[model samples]
Target chain A: MKEQLYGLITGILFGFLLQRAQVVRYDKQLGALRLCDMTIVKFMPSTILVGMLGVYLLLDLGLAKLSIKATVRKNMGSGLNIQQGRFSLQSQP
Target chain B: MKTILDKGWSPYLAGALSGIILILSVWFTGKYFGASTTFVRSAGLIEKMLNAPRISKMDYFVKKVPKIDWQWMFVVGILIGAVLASASSRIFRWKALPDMWEARFGHSRVKRGMVAFIGGVVAIFGARLAGG
Candidate 1:
């Protein structure tokens, strides 16, 4: 119950942020994808950096531990790689 | 209402806020931001209701059981939040088609709907294929 509540709060915050950033707007997304607007791109790196730094900090403080689940590894290894390869091939002229 | 609904926050400010929220979410819940899985789960749920046995046998469904989890609730929150934001912004207007769609497609509802449907299907299919 507590966890679900936490999820709900965070989800609302996330959604608010997305809306404020105009990411929910189709025009904004299309502009970002086409490289016409860099607003979304500017935000992406910051999120990645913050998340990465937080994880490392937690790990260093012994607050968090890493567990590489077998299924996740397998899915990434077979599913993601094959999909990437196919997409790259298709994108070529 | 006029003051609050006039304009949006600056992009940089919004981005900074998003970054902070992302960090907080990770720190508190230990989950990354994502909504694609919710869509998959939704599809799985409908399939389950129609043909439980067949859906259960599928490998994807086996791995990703369709239950209302945190991510699903998150998506619901997203919908609610979007509606709230739009309402506050005074930009909440009802239209079957948006200006951009009508401008590009010349006011053809069928064409617009078809294109949007196809785009959504392709996006979901690609997201699943990429293991998103």
Candidate 2:
């Protein structure tokens, strides 16, 4: 129950941010695809780096325990929960 | 009436705020904020309801959607939120199409629509192939 509330709060915060970023805008998404504006690219690495640092710090301090992510299951009955096949991480690949 | 939410916030600030929210979601719930998948699901349900064969056979379509309908509730929420925001921001320029799109496809509305439809299919299919 607590975890679900945590998730809802996070969703609200995230949604608000999405509204602000204009990322919700199709133009920015297309712009990133077109390479006309690299702001999104710049933001991606920063966000990942920040998250990684927080994770590493938590590990070092023994404040948070991390678990291996569940491996992508082959037959999850429905494809909904399954990882949508793997492919290159490159943009416009 | 149309002039409500006119002030645009700084994009950088907005981007940072977005990043913070995304990071928080990951930290708390272990999920990323993604609406495209929801869109994929909604489109699937709609096609299923209409009995569209093209939607059923494509591996790309099948993989991204849920078996049950109404799985796209979040997408509905997004649309509602956007509508509210537009109404609030006084930026609610309700056009059937945006001007930038006209620049891309010229005045042939049907051509533009077909191009958009086909482009979306290719984009999602290509993403599935390359992402997998």
Candidate 3:
């Protein structure tokens, strides 16, 4: 219940930010895809930097747990091997 | 209100705000932001509803259970937030084909819809394959 509330708040904030940044517009997205607009490029990196710093800080403070798992699947007949990995970090209650 | 709606926040300011929000999200939830997984889960849900037994057997569907998680709520929030923002800005308008699409591909609703649908399908598939 508490976690869902937190998620709701964060999601609202994220959506508001996206709208304010004008990236919700199809043209903005298309322009970014075509390399004609720098809005998304700028917005993404800044968000990544802030998120990374915050996550690391939380980890340092022992407020979060980082779990990483990797799986390797091999196709016997095709001789193809595929590796898939998922990394998740969750806040400690 | 009209003038305000016509103009948007400065890119730098918006970017900074988004960064701050991202930081806050991680600080509170310890989860990264993404919409792809929500899409995958939504597809799984539809498939489950259609044929539960078959969907349940699929590894992908089994691993990513069709449940309304935080990310799903996040997507809902996004839609509501967008509507709120548009309403506040008074720039909310409905149009099937945006100016850019019309200008680039001409005013063909069918064409626009088809292209968008195909693009969305490809993007979702790619995201799933990449395990994003």
* Candidate achieving the largest DockQ: 3
lDDT of predicted model 3: 0.76
A3-93 per-residue lDDT for model 2 (tens digits): 5455445555544444544455666667888988665675566556666666666567665455442433433433644333422333336
Which portions of model 1 miss their true places by more than 4 Å?
A65-93, B1-5
Q: What TM-score does each of the candidates earn?
A: 0.80, 0.57, 0.82
TM-score between model 3 and native:
0.82
Model 3 misplaced stretches (Cα beyond 4 Å): A66-93, B1-5
By how many angstroms RMSD does model 1 differ from the true structure?
6.5
- Candidate 2 lDDT over B1-132, as tens digits, reads 322234344556655655565555555555555445555666677778888788878897867654422223434544555555555565556565556676776787678778779998887777555342
Summarize candidate 1's per-residue lDDT along B22-118 as a digit string, tens digits.
Answer: 6676667776677898999999999999999999899988899997888888888877777777776777667887766677779888988899899
Q: Where's the lowest-lDDT run of ten residues in candidate 1 chain A? A: A62-71
DockQ of 1: 0.38
Q: Deviation in angstroms for A20 in model 3?
A: 1.2
RMSD of each: 6.5, 9.6, 8.9
Model 2: share of real contacts kept: 0.15
